[model samples]
Target: MNSVRRHALTGFAGLALVYLLLPIAVVILFSFNDPVGRFNYTWAGFTLDHWLNPLAVPGLGEAMRASIEIAFLSSLTATLLGTPIALALVRYAFRGRGTTNLFIFLPLTTPEVVLGASLLTLFLNLGVSTGFWTIVLAHIMFNVSFVVVTVRARLVGFDRHLEEAAMDLGANGWTTFTRVTLPLIAPGILAGALLAFALSIDDFVITLFTAGAQTTFPLWVYGASRIGVPPE
Candidate 1:
């Protein structure tokens, strides 16, 4: 009976994995497909033209470059800003600390549409024009919460005695942090930054609202979908 149940669970898990991965597998297979026309949805043939000339798609390279720039900037800014906030929350006891922690999650919980609308309103009120900077700022705003959360989770279980030991050995505060604390928390910080980058690159609703004329890669792909998406 136990063997039967184990087999059933294994089968179910395998099915779940396939369900999640089937579309990705199809996409990977079609990456090499040579479409007969503009739309690359249906498989026509297999060719290396798309791979050989990646820049064949008009505006695709520019859009991808813009997306990478924005994602990198936003992730870096969020990581820099959030690391301190996470450290403060974890290492210090201050007034309104609990409230601060709670508010950090508000952005995560709020609907993207509402956040976009609110940011648009704020930018309008401030007489700030929506453009690349606005998109970067919006991405940073959204990404910070995730960065803080990820880093904080890592910091929660960290041992403080290591820091004490470093200090006892004549290491200054800055040296202790740069050499010891930062290294220990590096993995979490990296995880958070990667998450920020992914979210920033994939963002659409907020980018749509905040971007005046600049198009990120995802936005470009979305616009291209109205006509036909090039394989590249």
Candidate 2:
């Protein structure tokens, strides 16, 4: 009975994995397809032409470059700003700590559509022009919350004795933080940065609201879908 149960669980896990990966497998398979028309929905023939000349389509390169730049800048800025906030919330007792924690979770709980609309309204009220910088700003705003949450989770399980040991060995506060605490929290920072990058690059609703003329990759894909999507 135990062996049978184990086999059943293994089968279930295999099915779940296939379910999750089926779409990705389809996308990979379709990338090599030589479509006869704008839509690459049906398989026609396999060719390497699309892979060889990925930027054959006009504006694809520009949109990709914009997406990469925004994702990098927003992720870096969010990580920098959020790391310190996570440290403070975890390592110190301060006024409004509870309120700050609540505010940090607000973005996570809030609907993306509502957040995008609110950001649009705020930008308009301030007479801020929607453009590349506006999109970056919006991405940073949302990314920071995720960064804080991720880093804070890492800090929650941190051992204080490592920093104490560094200090006991004649290290100053700055030295202890730089040498011990920073290294220990580096994984959390990296995880948060990667998460922010992914979120920024994949964002559509917020980017649509904030970007006036600049096109990111997701925005480009969305626009292309209206006509007919190219596999490349």
Which candidate number maximizes TM-score? 2
What TM-score would every model get versus the actual structure?
Answer: 0.92, 0.96
lDDT of 1 at 131: 93
TM-score of 2: 0.96
User: Candidate 2: where is the Cα deviation over 4 Å?
Assistant: none
Per residue, candidate 1 scores C-alpha lDDT tens digits across 27-98 of: 778879988887889999988777888876888988899999999999999999999999999999999998
Q: lDDT of candidate 2 vs native? A: 0.94
lDDT (Cα, tens digit) per residue for candidate 2, span 102-163:
98889899988998899989999999999999999999998999999999999999999998
Question: How many angstroms is residue 216 displaced in model 1 relative to the true structure, after the best TM-score fit?
Answer: 0.7
Report the lDDT of model 1 for residue 68: 92
Q: What stretches of model 1 exceed 4 Å from their correct place?
A: 1-10
